[model samples]
Target: MRHTLKTLLLCLLLPSAQVLAEEVQVAVAANFTAPMQVIAAAFEQDTGHQVKASFGSTGQLYAQITHGAPFDVFLAADDSTPAKLESEGATLGGSRFTYATGALALWSAQPDLVDHSGAVLRSDRFQHLAIANPKTAPYGMAATQVMAAQGLLEQLTPRLVEGQSIGQAYQFVASGNAELGFVALSQVYRDGQLSNGSAWLVPAELHDPIHQDAVILSKAAANPAATALVDYLRGERAAKIIRSFGYQL
Candidate 1:
Protein backbone atom coordinates (compact mmCIF):
# COMPACT_ATOMS: atom_id res chain seq x y z
CA MET A 1 0.00 0.00 0.00
CA ARG A 2 2.82 2.45 0.90
CA HIS A 3 4.72 1.67 -2.31
CA THR A 4 1.58 2.15 -4.44
CA LEU A 5 0.87 5.55 -2.86
CA LYS A 6 4.46 6.72 -3.44
CA THR A 7 4.32 5.53 -7.05
CA LEU A 8 1.08 7.39 -7.68
CA LEU A 9 2.47 10.62 -6.20
CA LEU A 10 5.60 10.36 -8.37
CA CYS A 11 3.55 9.80 -11.50
CA LEU A 12 1.37 12.85 -10.79
CA LEU A 13 4.31 15.09 -10.00
CA LEU A 14 6.27 14.00 -13.10
CA PRO A 15 3.77 15.41 -15.58
CA SER A 16 3.53 18.68 -13.70
CA ALA A 17 7.31 18.97 -13.62
CA GLN A 18 7.53 18.23 -17.31
CA VAL A 19 4.96 20.95 -18.07
CA LEU A 20 6.80 23.43 -15.93
CA ALA A 21 10.04 22.70 -17.77
CA GLU A 22 8.56 23.62 -21.11
CA GLU A 23 9.37 27.21 -22.14
CA VAL A 24 8.61 29.23 -25.22
CA GLN A 25 11.15 31.64 -26.61
CA VAL A 26 9.76 34.63 -28.47
CA ALA A 27 11.35 37.39 -30.50
CA VAL A 28 9.29 40.55 -30.12
CA ALA A 29 9.32 43.98 -31.69
CA ALA A 30 10.41 46.82 -29.43
CA ASN A 31 7.10 48.66 -29.72
CA PHE A 32 5.22 45.65 -28.37
CA THR A 33 7.29 45.33 -25.19
CA ALA A 34 4.84 46.76 -22.68
CA PRO A 35 1.82 44.88 -23.88
CA MET A 36 3.78 41.69 -24.44
CA GLN A 37 5.12 41.82 -20.90
CA VAL A 38 1.59 42.06 -19.56
CA ILE A 39 0.42 39.33 -21.86
CA ALA A 40 3.30 37.07 -20.86
CA ALA A 41 2.54 37.55 -17.17
CA ALA A 42 -1.12 36.75 -17.62
CA PHE A 43 -0.30 33.73 -19.76
CA GLU A 44 2.00 32.30 -17.12
CA GLN A 45 -0.64 32.77 -14.46
CA ASP A 46 -3.41 31.17 -16.50
CA THR A 47 -1.18 28.46 -17.94
CA GLY A 48 1.88 26.74 -16.55
CA HIS A 49 4.07 27.54 -19.58
CA GLN A 50 6.83 30.16 -19.39
CA VAL A 51 7.79 32.63 -22.10
CA LYS A 52 11.23 34.11 -22.65
CA ALA A 53 11.14 37.24 -24.77
CA SER A 54 13.82 39.19 -26.60
CA PHE A 55 12.92 42.65 -27.86
CA GLY A 56 14.53 44.47 -30.78
CA SER A 57 13.89 45.94 -34.22
CA THR A 58 11.73 43.71 -36.37
CA GLY A 59 14.38 43.74 -39.06
CA GLN A 60 16.97 42.48 -36.62
CA LEU A 61 14.68 39.79 -35.31
CA TYR A 62 13.98 38.65 -38.86
CA ALA A 63 17.66 38.20 -39.52
CA GLN A 64 18.07 36.25 -36.30
CA ILE A 65 15.17 33.93 -37.11
CA THR A 66 16.52 33.21 -40.57
CA HIS A 67 19.85 32.25 -39.06
CA GLY A 68 18.23 29.84 -36.58
CA ALA A 69 18.08 31.89 -33.38
CA PRO A 70 15.96 29.29 -31.57
CA PHE A 71 12.95 31.60 -31.36
CA ASP A 72 9.65 29.76 -31.23
CA VAL A 73 7.58 32.76 -32.26
CA PHE A 74 8.20 36.06 -34.00
CA LEU A 75 6.04 39.05 -33.16
CA ALA A 76 6.89 41.78 -35.63
CA ALA A 77 6.05 45.47 -35.65
CA ASP A 78 4.91 45.09 -39.25
CA ASP A 79 3.35 42.28 -41.27
CA SER A 80 6.20 42.15 -43.76
CA THR A 81 8.67 40.31 -41.55
CA PRO A 82 6.24 37.60 -40.49
CA ALA A 83 5.04 37.28 -44.07
CA LYS A 84 8.60 36.98 -45.23
CA LEU A 85 9.30 34.31 -42.68
CA GLU A 86 6.25 32.36 -43.72
CA SER A 87 7.16 32.59 -47.38
CA GLU A 88 10.71 31.47 -46.67
CA GLY A 89 9.47 28.44 -44.72
CA ALA A 90 10.93 29.78 -41.50
CA THR A 91 7.45 29.99 -40.05
CA LEU A 92 4.46 27.71 -40.24
CA GLY A 93 2.37 28.58 -43.26
CA GLY A 94 -1.00 30.16 -42.46
CA SER A 95 0.11 30.79 -38.91
CA ARG A 96 0.72 34.45 -39.59
CA PHE A 97 -1.93 36.78 -38.21
CA THR A 98 -2.20 40.47 -37.46
CA TYR A 99 -2.07 41.00 -33.73
CA ALA A 100 -2.15 44.76 -33.38
CA THR A 101 -2.07 48.09 -35.15
CA GLY A 102 0.46 50.54 -33.74
CA ALA A 103 0.18 54.31 -33.71
CA LEU A 104 2.91 56.90 -33.99
CA ALA A 105 3.21 59.95 -31.76
CA LEU A 106 5.55 62.86 -31.41
CA TRP A 107 6.63 62.97 -27.80
CA SER A 108 8.77 65.16 -25.59
CA ALA A 109 9.74 64.89 -21.97
CA GLN A 110 9.54 68.67 -21.60
CA PRO A 111 6.15 70.09 -20.75
CA ASP A 112 4.39 71.73 -23.69
CA LEU A 113 7.32 71.04 -25.98
CA VAL A 114 5.04 69.35 -28.44
CA ASP A 115 1.69 70.89 -29.20
CA HIS A 116 -1.41 68.88 -29.93
CA SER A 117 -1.32 70.15 -33.50
CA GLY A 118 2.29 68.91 -33.95
CA ALA A 119 3.46 72.43 -34.77
CA VAL A 120 6.65 71.75 -32.86
CA LEU A 121 8.04 69.72 -35.75
CA ARG A 122 8.16 72.93 -37.75
CA SER A 123 9.28 75.08 -34.87
CA ASP A 124 12.92 75.97 -34.17
CA ARG A 125 12.58 75.26 -30.44
CA PHE A 126 14.59 72.06 -30.81
CA GLN A 127 17.69 71.39 -32.90
CA HIS A 128 17.05 67.73 -33.43
CA LEU A 129 14.07 65.42 -33.88
CA ALA A 130 14.73 61.75 -33.23
CA ILE A 131 13.28 59.05 -35.43
CA ALA A 132 13.97 55.35 -35.79
CA ASN A 133 16.07 54.20 -38.70
CA PRO A 134 13.52 54.00 -41.48
CA LYS A 135 15.36 51.17 -43.18
CA THR A 136 15.08 48.90 -40.14
CA ALA A 137 12.38 50.01 -37.73
CA PRO A 138 8.71 49.91 -38.71
CA TYR A 139 7.94 52.96 -36.59
CA GLY A 140 10.79 54.77 -38.36
CA MET A 141 9.23 53.89 -41.71
CA ALA A 142 5.91 55.27 -40.48
CA ALA A 143 7.57 58.44 -39.24
CA THR A 144 9.22 58.93 -42.61
CA GLN A 145 5.92 58.39 -44.33
CA VAL A 146 4.24 60.95 -42.07
CA MET A 147 6.95 63.55 -42.75
CA ALA A 148 6.72 62.87 -46.44
CA ALA A 149 2.93 63.16 -46.38
CA GLN A 150 3.21 66.50 -44.57
CA GLY A 151 5.94 67.66 -47.00
CA LEU A 152 8.32 68.05 -44.05
CA LEU A 153 10.75 65.25 -44.93
CA GLU A 154 13.23 67.47 -46.74
CA GLN A 155 13.07 70.16 -44.09
CA LEU A 156 13.34 67.74 -41.17
CA THR A 157 16.12 65.61 -42.62
CA PRO A 158 18.89 67.93 -41.48
CA ARG A 159 17.73 67.88 -37.84
CA LEU A 160 17.08 64.16 -37.52
CA VAL A 161 18.75 61.86 -35.02
CA GLU A 162 18.37 58.25 -36.02
CA GLY A 163 17.76 55.44 -33.54
CA GLN A 164 18.19 51.75 -34.28
CA SER A 165 14.70 50.96 -33.01
CA ILE A 166 11.50 52.73 -31.97
CA GLY A 167 12.28 52.16 -28.30
CA GLN A 168 15.65 53.80 -28.75
CA ALA A 169 14.03 56.72 -30.54
CA TYR A 170 11.66 57.14 -27.60
CA GLN A 171 14.66 57.04 -25.30
CA PHE A 172 16.33 59.81 -27.28
CA VAL A 173 13.48 62.17 -26.57
CA ALA A 174 12.78 60.90 -23.06
CA SER A 175 16.41 61.43 -22.08
CA GLY A 176 16.35 64.99 -23.52
CA ASN A 177 19.00 64.19 -26.14
CA ALA A 178 16.39 65.19 -28.67
CA GLU A 179 13.71 67.66 -27.72
CA LEU A 180 11.03 65.69 -29.51
CA GLY A 181 10.77 62.35 -31.35
CA PHE A 182 8.32 60.06 -33.02
CA VAL A 183 7.54 56.95 -30.97
CA ALA A 184 4.90 54.26 -30.53
CA LEU A 185 1.82 55.34 -28.51
CA SER A 186 2.22 52.25 -26.34
CA GLN A 187 5.53 53.54 -25.00
CA VAL A 188 4.00 56.65 -23.51
CA TYR A 189 1.34 54.83 -21.54
CA ARG A 190 1.20 53.05 -18.20
CA ASP A 191 -1.97 51.28 -17.07
CA GLY A 192 -3.85 52.89 -19.98
CA GLN A 193 -2.79 56.41 -19.06
CA LEU A 194 -0.09 58.51 -20.63
CA SER A 195 3.05 58.96 -18.60
CA ASN A 196 4.69 62.28 -17.79
CA GLY A 197 5.20 63.80 -21.21
CA SER A 198 3.79 65.99 -23.91
CA ALA A 199 2.67 64.23 -27.07
CA TRP A 200 0.74 64.54 -30.29
CA LEU A 201 -0.84 61.43 -31.74
CA VAL A 202 -0.13 61.48 -35.43
CA PRO A 203 -3.16 61.04 -37.60
CA ALA A 204 -3.45 57.67 -39.30
CA GLU A 205 -3.76 59.41 -42.63
CA LEU A 206 -0.22 60.60 -42.25
CA HIS A 207 1.19 57.15 -43.00
CA ASP A 208 0.40 53.60 -43.95
CA PRO A 209 -1.26 51.48 -41.25
CA ILE A 210 1.10 49.66 -38.91
CA HIS A 211 -0.33 46.16 -38.95
CA GLN A 212 1.71 44.10 -36.52
CA ASP A 213 1.77 40.36 -36.99
CA ALA A 214 2.80 37.19 -35.17
CA VAL A 215 3.73 33.71 -36.37
CA ILE A 216 4.88 30.36 -35.04
CA LEU A 217 8.23 29.28 -36.35
CA SER A 218 8.25 26.17 -38.51
CA LYS A 219 10.79 24.62 -36.20
CA ALA A 220 8.63 25.27 -33.17
CA ALA A 221 5.19 24.26 -34.36
CA ALA A 222 5.53 20.96 -32.53
CA ASN A 223 6.69 22.64 -29.34
CA PRO A 224 3.82 22.39 -26.88
CA ALA A 225 4.78 25.59 -25.10
CA ALA A 226 5.06 27.45 -28.42
CA THR A 227 1.65 26.30 -29.54
CA ALA A 228 0.20 27.25 -26.17
CA LEU A 229 1.66 30.74 -26.44
CA VAL A 230 0.16 31.23 -29.89
CA ASP A 231 -3.21 30.04 -28.66
CA TYR A 232 -3.01 32.37 -25.65
CA LEU A 233 -2.33 35.30 -27.96
CA ARG A 234 -5.51 34.61 -29.89
CA GLY A 235 -7.66 34.04 -26.81
CA GLU A 236 -10.08 36.66 -25.44
CA ARG A 237 -8.15 37.44 -22.28
CA ALA A 238 -4.89 38.20 -24.11
CA ALA A 239 -6.69 40.21 -26.78
CA LYS A 240 -8.34 42.35 -24.13
CA ILE A 241 -5.02 42.98 -22.41
CA ILE A 242 -3.42 43.96 -25.70
CA ARG A 243 -6.25 46.36 -26.53
CA SER A 244 -5.92 47.97 -23.12
CA PHE A 245 -2.34 48.87 -23.99
CA GLY A 246 -3.35 51.26 -26.83
CA TYR A 247 -3.08 48.67 -29.57
CA GLN A 248 -5.80 48.63 -32.21
CA LEU A 249 -7.28 45.27 -33.11
Candidate 2:
Protein backbone atom coordinates (compact mmCIF):
# COMPACT_ATOMS: atom_id res chain seq x y z
CA MET A 1 0.00 0.00 0.00
CA ARG A 2 2.86 2.43 0.87
CA HIS A 3 4.65 1.60 -2.39
CA THR A 4 1.47 2.28 -4.38
CA LEU A 5 0.99 5.63 -2.58
CA LYS A 6 4.60 6.69 -3.27
CA THR A 7 4.27 5.76 -6.97
CA LEU A 8 1.06 7.79 -7.26
CA LEU A 9 2.71 10.85 -5.65
CA LEU A 10 5.68 10.56 -7.99
CA CYS A 11 3.36 10.57 -11.02
CA LEU A 12 1.54 13.66 -9.69
CA LEU A 13 4.77 15.61 -9.03
CA LEU A 14 6.47 14.81 -12.38
CA PRO A 15 4.16 17.03 -14.43
CA SER A 16 4.68 19.97 -12.07
CA ALA A 17 8.45 19.62 -12.46
CA GLN A 18 8.15 19.61 -16.21
CA VAL A 19 5.89 22.67 -16.12
CA LEU A 20 8.40 24.52 -13.93
CA ALA A 21 11.16 24.16 -16.50
CA GLU A 22 11.67 27.36 -18.46
CA GLU A 23 13.57 28.33 -21.57
CA VAL A 24 16.22 31.08 -21.73
CA GLN A 25 16.83 32.89 -24.94
CA VAL A 26 20.53 33.77 -25.15
CA ALA A 27 22.51 35.95 -27.50
CA VAL A 28 26.02 34.52 -27.67
CA ALA A 29 29.17 35.76 -29.28
CA ALA A 30 30.26 33.70 -32.27
CA ASN A 31 33.55 32.70 -30.69
CA PHE A 32 31.77 30.96 -27.85
CA THR A 33 29.50 28.80 -29.97
CA ALA A 34 31.17 25.44 -29.35
CA PRO A 35 31.59 25.75 -25.63
CA MET A 36 28.17 27.27 -25.22
CA GLN A 37 26.65 24.37 -27.10
CA VAL A 38 28.28 21.93 -24.70
CA ILE A 39 27.41 24.01 -21.67
CA ALA A 40 23.83 24.44 -22.79
CA ALA A 41 23.37 20.70 -23.12
CA ALA A 42 24.73 20.14 -19.63
CA PHE A 43 22.66 22.95 -18.19
CA GLU A 44 19.49 21.56 -19.72
CA GLN A 45 20.18 18.07 -18.47
CA ASP A 46 21.00 19.22 -14.96
CA THR A 47 18.38 21.91 -14.38
CA GLY A 48 15.63 20.96 -16.79
CA HIS A 49 15.87 24.48 -18.26
CA GLN A 50 16.25 24.91 -22.00
CA VAL A 51 18.78 27.27 -23.60
CA LYS A 52 18.09 28.75 -26.99
CA ALA A 53 21.19 30.56 -28.22
CA SER A 54 21.63 32.88 -31.15
CA PHE A 55 25.23 33.42 -32.21
CA GLY A 56 26.76 36.43 -33.92
CA SER A 57 29.52 38.99 -33.62
CA THR A 58 29.43 40.86 -30.33
CA GLY A 59 28.91 44.27 -31.91
CA GLN A 60 26.13 42.96 -34.14
CA LEU A 61 24.47 41.30 -31.19
CA TYR A 62 24.72 44.53 -29.20
CA ALA A 63 23.10 46.41 -32.04
CA GLN A 64 20.23 43.97 -32.05
CA ILE A 65 19.78 44.32 -28.32
CA THR A 66 19.70 48.10 -28.58
CA HIS A 67 17.13 47.77 -31.34
CA GLY A 68 14.95 45.71 -28.98
CA ALA A 69 15.74 42.12 -29.79
CA PRO A 70 14.07 39.84 -27.26
CA PHE A 71 17.08 38.10 -25.76
CA ASP A 72 16.98 37.18 -22.12
CA VAL A 73 20.73 36.78 -21.61
CA PHE A 74 23.80 37.91 -23.52
CA LEU A 75 27.23 36.28 -23.58
CA ALA A 76 29.49 38.73 -25.33
CA ALA A 77 33.02 38.35 -26.70
CA ASP A 78 34.19 41.54 -25.04
CA ASP A 79 33.40 43.17 -21.69
CA SER A 80 32.68 46.54 -23.27
CA THR A 81 29.39 45.59 -24.94
CA PRO A 82 27.91 44.25 -21.74
CA ALA A 83 29.12 47.35 -19.91
CA LYS A 84 27.54 49.53 -22.56
CA LEU A 85 24.24 47.75 -22.16
CA GLU A 86 24.44 48.13 -18.41
CA SER A 87 25.17 51.82 -18.68
CA GLU A 88 22.18 52.21 -20.96
CA GLY A 89 19.98 50.54 -18.34
CA ALA A 90 19.26 47.66 -20.65
CA THR A 91 20.71 45.12 -18.26
CA LEU A 92 19.92 44.01 -14.75
CA GLY A 93 22.29 45.70 -12.34
CA GLY A 94 24.93 43.55 -10.62
CA SER A 95 24.18 40.63 -12.90
CA ARG A 96 27.23 40.93 -15.10
CA PHE A 97 30.48 38.95 -14.84
CA THR A 98 33.44 37.92 -16.90
CA TYR A 99 32.92 34.46 -18.31
CA ALA A 100 36.05 33.92 -20.40
CA THR A 101 39.23 35.47 -21.77
CA GLY A 102 39.57 34.88 -25.50
CA ALA A 103 42.75 34.40 -27.47
CA LEU A 104 43.46 34.97 -31.16
CA ALA A 105 44.85 32.42 -33.56
CA LEU A 106 46.08 32.72 -37.13
CA TRP A 107 44.71 29.64 -38.83
CA SER A 108 45.10 27.96 -42.19
CA ALA A 109 43.11 25.05 -43.53
CA GLN A 110 46.24 23.35 -44.85
CA PRO A 111 48.42 21.50 -42.41
CA ASP A 112 51.89 23.05 -41.77
CA LEU A 113 50.93 26.22 -43.65
CA VAL A 114 51.24 28.29 -40.48
CA ASP A 115 54.24 28.02 -38.25
CA HIS A 116 54.24 28.25 -34.49
CA SER A 117 55.89 31.70 -34.56
CA GLY A 118 53.40 33.00 -37.17
CA ALA A 119 56.28 33.69 -39.54
CA VAL A 120 53.92 33.03 -42.43
CA LEU A 121 52.35 36.45 -41.96
CA ARG A 122 55.66 38.09 -42.79
CA SER A 123 56.15 35.86 -45.78
CA ASP A 124 54.70 36.31 -49.28
CA ARG A 125 53.58 32.74 -49.73
CA PHE A 126 49.88 33.47 -49.27
CA GLN A 127 47.99 35.89 -51.50
CA HIS A 128 45.06 36.59 -49.24
CA LEU A 129 44.56 36.63 -45.51
CA ALA A 130 41.15 36.94 -43.93
CA ILE A 131 40.10 38.89 -40.88
CA ALA A 132 36.73 39.66 -39.39
CA ASN A 133 35.52 43.22 -39.74
CA PRO A 134 37.22 45.21 -37.01
CA LYS A 135 34.16 47.37 -36.62
CA THR A 136 31.98 44.49 -35.46
CA ALA A 137 34.19 41.70 -34.25
CA PRO A 138 36.59 41.83 -31.32
CA TYR A 139 38.73 39.06 -32.79
CA GLY A 140 39.06 41.05 -36.00
CA MET A 141 40.28 44.03 -34.02
CA ALA A 142 42.73 41.82 -32.23
CA ALA A 143 43.94 40.47 -35.56
CA THR A 144 44.69 43.98 -36.74
CA GLN A 145 46.42 44.68 -33.45
CA VAL A 146 48.60 41.61 -33.92
CA MET A 147 49.52 42.68 -37.42
CA ALA A 148 50.29 46.22 -36.26
CA ALA A 149 52.41 44.98 -33.40
CA GLN A 150 54.35 42.85 -35.86
CA GLY A 151 54.63 45.81 -38.26
CA LEU A 152 52.75 43.91 -40.97
CA LEU A 153 49.40 45.73 -40.97
CA GLU A 154 50.30 48.32 -43.63
CA GLN A 155 52.14 45.79 -45.78
CA LEU A 156 49.42 43.15 -45.43
CA THR A 157 46.54 45.55 -45.91
CA PRO A 158 46.45 44.99 -49.65
CA ARG A 159 46.11 41.27 -49.16
CA LEU A 160 43.41 41.43 -46.53
CA VAL A 161 39.94 39.93 -46.87
CA GLU A 162 37.20 41.00 -44.53
CA GLY A 163 34.41 38.85 -43.15
CA GLN A 164 31.36 40.03 -41.30
CA SER A 165 32.20 37.85 -38.33
CA ILE A 166 34.96 35.57 -37.06
CA GLY A 167 32.93 32.53 -37.99
CA GLN A 168 32.73 33.79 -41.51
CA ALA A 169 36.40 34.62 -41.54
CA TYR A 170 37.17 31.07 -40.52
CA GLN A 171 34.91 29.89 -43.25
CA PHE A 172 36.85 31.98 -45.73
CA VAL A 173 40.01 30.09 -44.84
CA ALA A 174 38.30 26.71 -44.65
CA SER A 175 36.85 27.24 -48.08
CA GLY A 176 40.24 28.38 -49.49
CA ASN A 177 38.92 31.81 -50.39
CA ALA A 178 41.59 33.11 -48.05
CA GLU A 179 44.71 31.07 -47.47
CA LEU A 180 44.81 32.01 -43.82
CA GLY A 181 42.76 33.99 -41.33
CA PHE A 182 42.63 35.23 -37.81
CA VAL A 183 40.13 33.35 -35.68
CA ALA A 184 39.35 32.67 -32.06
CA LEU A 185 41.66 30.10 -30.53
CA SER A 186 38.62 28.27 -29.23
CA GLN A 187 37.39 27.66 -32.74
CA VAL A 188 40.49 25.70 -33.73
CA TYR A 189 41.30 24.19 -30.39
CA ARG A 190 39.65 21.54 -28.26
CA ASP A 191 40.70 19.32 -25.39
CA GLY A 192 44.07 21.04 -25.03
CA GLN A 193 45.04 20.74 -28.69
CA LEU A 194 44.27 22.02 -32.13
CA SER A 195 41.27 20.28 -33.62
CA ASN A 196 42.63 20.42 -37.19
CA GLY A 197 44.66 22.44 -39.64
CA SER A 198 47.59 24.65 -38.71
CA ALA A 199 47.48 27.70 -36.44
CA TRP A 200 49.68 30.19 -34.73
CA LEU A 201 48.33 31.17 -31.34
CA VAL A 202 48.80 34.91 -31.23
CA PRO A 203 50.51 36.15 -28.14
CA ALA A 204 48.18 37.95 -25.78
CA GLU A 205 50.69 40.79 -25.37
CA LEU A 206 50.14 41.83 -28.98
CA HIS A 207 46.60 42.98 -28.21
CA ASP A 208 44.40 44.13 -25.39
CA PRO A 209 42.80 41.37 -23.34
CA ILE A 210 39.59 39.98 -24.78
CA HIS A 211 37.61 39.57 -21.59
CA GLN A 212 34.22 38.07 -22.42
CA ASP A 213 31.31 38.91 -20.18
CA ALA A 214 27.76 37.70 -19.61
CA VAL A 215 24.77 39.69 -18.46
CA ILE A 216 21.07 39.37 -17.80
CA LEU A 217 19.09 41.77 -19.95
CA SER A 218 16.43 44.01 -18.44
CA LYS A 219 13.87 42.09 -20.44
CA ALA A 220 14.78 38.98 -18.50
CA ALA A 221 14.90 40.51 -15.06
CA ALA A 222 12.04 38.30 -13.97
CA ASN A 223 13.27 35.18 -15.74
CA PRO A 224 14.37 32.49 -13.35
CA ALA A 225 15.94 30.46 -16.16
CA ALA A 226 18.01 33.44 -17.26
CA THR A 227 19.39 33.92 -13.77
CA ALA A 228 19.97 30.21 -13.42
CA LEU A 229 21.90 30.07 -16.71
CA VAL A 230 24.11 32.93 -15.62
CA ASP A 231 24.79 31.24 -12.30
CA TYR A 232 25.55 27.97 -14.06
CA LEU A 233 28.20 29.66 -16.20
CA ARG A 234 30.10 30.66 -13.08
CA GLY A 235 30.20 27.16 -11.74
CA GLU A 236 33.14 24.74 -11.99
CA ARG A 237 31.36 22.48 -14.44
CA ALA A 238 30.90 25.32 -16.87
CA ALA A 239 34.42 26.55 -16.23
CA LYS A 240 35.79 23.15 -17.14
CA ILE A 241 33.80 23.11 -20.35
CA ILE A 242 34.96 26.63 -21.21
CA ARG A 243 38.56 25.66 -20.62
CA SER A 244 38.24 22.62 -22.84
CA PHE A 245 37.56 24.95 -25.74
CA GLY A 246 40.80 26.94 -25.08
CA TYR A 247 39.17 29.88 -23.27
CA GLN A 248 40.69 31.22 -20.08
CA LEU A 249 38.32 31.47 -17.16
Model 2, 46-115: lDDT tens digits are 9999899999999999999999998999999999999999999999999999999999999999998999
Best by lDDT: 2
Residue 192's C-alpha lDDT in candidate 2? 94
lDDT of 1: 0.90
Candidate 1 lDDT by residue in tens digits, 150-248: 889999999999999998999999899999999999999666767878999899889999999999999886688888998899999988888777788
TM-score of 2: 0.91
Q: TM-score for all predictions?
A: 0.91, 0.91
lDDT at position 104, candidate 1: 88
